[model samples]
Target chain A: MSDHHKETFISKYVFSLDHKMIAKQFLITGMFMGIIGMLMSIMFRLQLSNPGESFAVLEWFLGSKWAPGGILDPNMYLSLVTMHGTILVFWVLTAGLTGTFANFLIPLQIGARDMASGFMNMLSYWFFFAATIILLCSLFVETGPASAGWTIYPPLSALPQAIPGSGLGQDLWLVSIALFIVSSLLGGLNYIVTILNLRTKGMSMSRLPLTMWAILITAILGVLSFPVLLAAALLLIFDRSFGTSFYLSDIIIGGEALHHTGGSPVLFEHLFWFLGHPEVYIILLPSLGIVSEVMSVNTRKPIFGYKAMVGAMLAIAFLSFIVWGHHMFITGMDPFLGSVFTFTTLLIAIPSAVKVFNYLATLWKGSIRFTPAMLFTIGFVSTFITGGLTGLILGDSALDINVHDTYFVVGHFHIVMGLSAIYGMFSGVYHWFPKMYGRMMNKKLGYLHFWVTFIAAYGVFFPMHFLGLAGLPRRYYTNSAFPMFDNLTDINSIITFFAIVGGLVQLVFVFNFFYSIFKGTKASENPWESNTLEWTTPVERIHGNWPGEIPTVHRWPYDYSKPGADKDFVMQTEPLKEGKTEH
Target chain B: MSTSKNNTSKQLLWIAMAGIFMFFAGLTSAVIVRSAEHGWDSIDMPIWFWYSTAAIILSSLLLIIAKWQVKKGNSPSIYVLGALALGLFFGYCQVKGWDQLTAMGMYFVGEGSNPSSSFLYVITFAHLVHVIGGLVALIITSVKSLQSKYTKDNYLGIELVSIYWHFLDVLWVYLFVFLLYSVK
Candidate 1:
């Protein structure tokens, strides 16, 4: 209700209640976390490629304790791997992608002044910040960060005796995750409510941008699924701290009989993957949303098959819940149940194929602008296809048993979920940089960032598939144990080279992002000439998005290249010409 | 800021309730699966649990009456306080129930514990934690009603708290039946 107000620096920037400011907060924090995650990956990549070799950088970053004699300790290697996955998946992709875009676009695109409860949105970012602090603080603990992989499966994650990282680091990991879940739930609730209840006049659910639909569904998925992760993590906490055996059973750690019995780790697996599988979509759907909007704008065409895209995303979200069992197939589940999981898992391919076809069809013969955002959108599709194909192989229970935790699985997820989502985030940052910062990022730097990342991403992950097929299990400190795997050493070295290149290329983006905020070219009101409500607002940031009255949406967001339209793109606020039916 | 005629807070509460439902759904499913495993010792439902269940049910009834009073343009502070009292009573009974289980040699963890008893303690404790949240909302609502912050036409606060309290009440009923059926 209070749109116009004089503000101090603290109210405006630090603890702002404005959704746009909050979105920027999420973005900066996510990028900070992303750099840390990327650095961790490069550290482990070096260790993996050049086993037993000393790296001065590792000692510099990790200090002499974890990297004595400049070589990474075996336990610390697992910590790097674990924190890398945790940070990238949860902090960078899930929180960063949805947290940034959803907050920025939901109000502006939907014609609202702010989130339903601006205070809650601020709390969401602060909670995420707190969670980030705790998780980062975990790395400095005496033992190490949680190292039982990001999955944090127990017996390993449960007992400090099993792994040194399990002691305080795992406890902090659970607490941080619990707070992160709360932050996401708070943000998710606001997203769902604002999108549903705050749309301007004439903006029906069907007429809203695909980004809104994707984000709304993504928020819903987070709401339903993340609590299960909270549940799983809580039980794991009890197992670790309270001497409960929710996951641990019949243990003989250090040649001593434990009092715990009857608890099954499979129960933990069931609960974890329930959230874990949906968590993948929670990371990807926002990107899918952003890509749809970016492709529609850059290609100068209405997104093809809008209804089908909505239906397909819904289908994917629904299937995501059922298909989580595919991740646990090798846990000795019944063959019948595994078959059911396999069937459900592959059914996702249908909707996924529909989405891919829609993106291709949208691009077919359209006047495509080869902007940096468009390049990453195209890259996202490429990696989504490349990574999704391997999913078919991994989804089968019989086939998965052979390579469940191998480098193939690693390659598969990194390409599909990791690369694809990161590309979507980059696409979003480039496309909406003007709206977020009121300035343009350097196009040359953007192009350089996209090209190097694209090549290095494929270079890094594509070879891991072959190594996985060759039976190189993932998360190994060194594959120097068996001479049978000796021949794959060169490929690991190649992958590591690409990995380092990819990790470094992100700096081009970081520099472009920060530099453009202050010194880059001042943006026009609508640089992309997009047909969305967000582009209708002034370039300067304001508490309420629009200066005067919020414009009422008159048509769908995608109205590019309509016949008889004077311009190629039509803003959603424009009245249709007489007898011009809305799309 | 929003011009639409939608009840956003209600929608948010319902969505949050769905998430909370999933949370308990996860815990209950774990209970069923773990009960089928070896070395699970089934424990009887603690006597105080039934009393706590009744307290929460009656607490919901008081909130219903409070809502009715608001609709009639009367102060609902007394009924709201009644609901808060019963909410506190429900929490007390839950602790007593856990105490009763300890007396029965059923423990949450450590020596002489079983997974069945652990699930019981954790699920009920989690529910009680939520009940405490509901009690906090109840306190705020009763205080606001005393200050006449709500009226016949303006009772979103009362309505929201009622919805959440009823959901928790219903949730406890579901858990009670589920624990009765599965925890044995």
Candidate 2:
């Protein structure tokens, strides 16, 4: 390794080969993208609540082109929704969540000096940076950003003349996504290799922290599934650019029949959902891993059923691939095939239930810390359960036929995957803040942020279920067109109010995070008294994690409050006693 | 580098190979799905694709010999150079195959194109892109071998290149057979 002392500002801060630095880069970029995505949501919610009413803030952000007279153009509403989902799902949650934690925690918890290849890690960040720029640039194009939904389903995405937002903006969206896939592949390859090969001598697979296992599995999931997305995107690109009829057929646009024939948009759906479903697990699993560790440390107990947690993760990962067809049940698929997908989809609830029960058992009859991180962990479980129950209703093809594209589906996923994953991410940030910056965040601000966010999140999404059940379809610019939806206006206003509140609460988190980075009290090495190897590292950041030899792991990472231990927590580096057995 | 670091590179290569395999798998499945539709036009297997397959297999053989020479503590420059030459020849044959495809009136796009023919073109071009990646690796390995940078104790670069080369060869053969039989 090069001498850390000789590093210049550009080398240290900009293009540094350190894993920690690369992780911080992912965090900052992900948060910036998250802010953009949230603002887009707020803008769309404003349109949804008032439906053609003027909002000066909309005019300010979108200008006269998209939000003329402060009323968001219908095309821009779809653009904001598309960009919001694309940015949050892919950029913020997938790359941001996995990229940050995987890069930060893999080497530290596994007791390695660095990733298997630091140069590739740096390349991963740059590719993501480039992809981010391209996606952002799409917004400035005359056509506006891609408005064909985040899925970019064919017929609409394939034909530029089909929609006003389909011109250069869709092309940029595809290019950005392709580049993002490359970035993730590079990052995933590094994470998998480092964890498999670079663990210190005594660290076995079973002995690894849950975070490492989750990341390793998530990386594998990415490697296997992302390439399929690349294939899908490549065909879509060919269709869009080269006049190939892969995903378009029987289309009469502008009173003219183009030559496209014999292609099925259902093929694109099949290809997309193959990656899309596993992508849900990809976003949620890392948070699950982080929450597991944080819950164990805060509750002062060994994580309930360590092997079961790992098993459930593996089961969920495997089942994710098969359950994708459930998303396509309403696409005129065969009833028998839909039944098969439904069966597989319901099977996922078994493992999910196992994980939830294990978390509850871990928190039962324990010395709970109720720290900001723990509060978020508990909040994650609550939303996970609330949102997951609705999944059962949505998973059934018969029931799903009623609420397939309704706000019910939106409400369900936001609470389950979106809210749960974000909660997990916040919990991880609060827990690891001291480790990342060597400064403590304000606990008071954290508590306030958690309470408001938790309440406001539920307040926003919970009402959407009722709206969806009342036949209020999603992706509609306004409900004013139909007199049937007139009664739901009050409910819409209430949801938007909570959404604005929820959006504002994140600023508290942002202020606390940035302020604490420089001005918060200096944190000790092991502020949380966790058993993981990361807490054993020095408070001051260094090139390699440990100053001297890497410590050898002697036990599993969940050894909290063991009988007759010197302290409440036992670091993984501590050896077993003479008569004690390895747990 | 330590043994584990070496293992890390090898493992990374294998995982990358798996990813590439999945990419092809996805494309081939699309071909199956799309061909089941009406108006599907199946093009004949081009003669040059057969020639390209043979060239890639020969290139893999030369790479294997070069790896053996490294084990015997001899300069593997000749063998590595032979492998690189054959890889270039293989790439040349692929372009010729595409020409043959066009000559047979199978267009990847435009007025004459069909989805089946387009799938064939896209799948083969994607495979060719990967072969080009392998060729770059081979070129670097050959240069290093000519400078005697690889020894019996440290030939990881050569091994990685050879592994990728062999996988590419196998991949082409499988794709060749699958396309020939499955395009109908």
Candidate 3:
């Protein structure tokens, strides 16, 4: 494992087994997917904001069949919305957030040479790469991509003749998803094995950083829950391709009755949400973990209530499984079952509250540095609280009956899980760029990116709650379909305007990220003056992580401003003095 | 140090097995719930399935013997080949069983079928797929054992394949019992 090997281009960049290179691949691919997803949202927002108005920009991107005479076809509108949700949820948030950070940080923070099985790690990325290609290929098919929404509920998804997009497009979507599941399982297993077995000497489970704990739990959740989604996908595949009635039921289309019978669509919902609810936590916990580390470093204090934070995360993971029924409360589930779900869903708030309070406690009365990472961490806390409070209303079976499938549900999830997670990701990129690339992002550009994104995010979603309250249903191509909804047209326009602005602001980050990698200020080994083991590595990336033997951990990662310490932060590799006790 | 690494790899295999178990648990639960609904008509179990079940059980017994023989510092290829042959035969019998069902007009899809028989076809087909994966592993281990790659003190590959083969054998038994009681 020497650093002086004559590495070729393919082994170094294209198909390397190094965790750092693989992590960069995930980040860049995720960013590419995020751009596509964001552009789709902006396209649909234009159609929503101005119902019948034709824009040449739409014609340029979508071409004649979809946006003839510049007006978006109604079916294509649904297609954009569906692909947007699917790509962002699965490809961007799930893969991008977890894949990028987990692969990057797991070995560095845990003091491992590499993943326990590097070959499997390489296989995982290729699976994800193939899945991405297959999914993108679906867009070029004659009928368009899977348009039954990101959930791809059956009857619509199972019966090809039901919608034009249900033909080859949906088949490709299922194949892509099945491939993605395989990739995730492979990656998740590798993370678990590496964390469980490959920690450096003295890095016990308790001494492990919060980021490692979050990733470990996230991997466990993925291993258990993703298989259920695979089963759901397989059954849907059987119904669609093999003509089995696993999810299809008695239906009449085009004056003909379908052969499918005795099967329940509710069953598909049951299976999908079983993976779907934990998926929210899966998307959020990594950011939550990153925010904890960033907040401690920037505030010059130890993370408040570290044990309680870990306990809260574990509690949230356990509670995520039982609370999925809340998503189906309005679908005529058993009222008793709904009540049980509502209780479990609301009980999650206790752990969530503990985490938020601990974050605020860490920031209180401390000498806080307002780095871009810290600002984004604060933004995450804000959106997490705001979005989370709305869940209480939606979780109540009685209240959810009114807001189900409305803009209110959309607003709640986007703000809490969507924006909060994205902010956490931004915080991580800004904080860890130095470690990853040995360069610093421009702070002024970082500040500009943060404020605009923060303000515009709230500007876009905050008003959607009122529209939901006004009884406007989601997935409507035009609010003009109902005269009663005509009054809220102005609000839709405002939301769309802010969404476009927010979407454009992301380009600043894109520019900053690429520009900083090549030309930004050079960073020292410990630029953030953090206590974590990752910063202890030299600025240059290496194969086995260290030129010599890996460093041993003598204390926990979050030892900021400890009493009797010479400096404000003590590196985890520092040895304990004769008289001082380890924090 | 090498022994600890071997243990960790084995532990990873078990964790993966648990995940596979949850997958089947989900599908089986769906079958029971789907069966309870209206318009559900039950079909008779094909006799070939019973033979396939016995073949898989014997395959598991052969693998156990192979494991025992290897640990005793003896050549285990005879038992390994015996298990692999039975495993392939079990797969052939499963295809024959499906063909028999189709002959008897119990379709997995289309007008002649009920959801109950469809569940039978699906659950069995999924298990057969995993069994195929086990067969591939068995074949590789058989080659390694013939080359004397494994020793009495280091038979991790043999042990992993045997453990996985037996798990598949046990899984098929559970699915068979479930289908027997539930599929009329």
Top DockQ model: 2
TM-score of chain A of 3: 0.99
Can you give the lDDT of residue A525 in candidate 2?
Answer: 98
Candidate 3 structure quality by residue, lDDT tens digits, A150-237:
9999888999888878888899999999999998989998899889888999899998889889999888888888998999898999
* TM-score of every candidate: 0.99, 0.99, 0.98
Q: Estimate candidate 2's alpha-carbon lDDT, on a 0 to 1 scale.
A: 0.93
lDDT of 1 by residue, A1-583 (tens): 5665788999999999999999999999999999999999999999889999999999999999999988999999999999999999999999999999999999999999999999999999999999999999999999989899999998889887788888888889988999999999999999999999988988999998999999999999999999898898889888888889999888997789988788999999999999999999999999999999999999999999999999999999999999888988888899999999999999999999999999999999999999999999999999999999999999999999999889999999999999999999999999999999999999999999999999999999999999999999999999999898999999999999999998888988998999999999999999998999999888888899888888988899899998888999999999888887887
- Checking candidate 3 for backbone clashes, the offending pairs are none
Task: Give the share of true interchain contacts found in each model.
Answer: 0.87, 0.82, 0.57
Cα lDDT tens digits for candidate 2, B62-158: 8889889999998889989998999899889889988988898888888888898888899999998998899899889888888899999999999
Q: What docking grade does candidate 2 earn?
A: high
lDDT against the true structure, per candidate, is 0.93, 0.93, 0.91
lDDT per residue (tens digit) for residues A269-291 in model 2: 98999899999999999999999
Which ranges in model 2 have alpha carbons more than 4 Å from their true place? A2-5
Per-residue CA lDDT of model 3 for B88-124, tens digit only, reads: 9999999999999999899888888888888889899
Cand. 2: chain B TM-score: 0.97
Worst 10 residues of 2 chain A by lDDT: A1-10
- Give the C-alpha miss distance for residue A171 in model 1, angstroms: 1.5
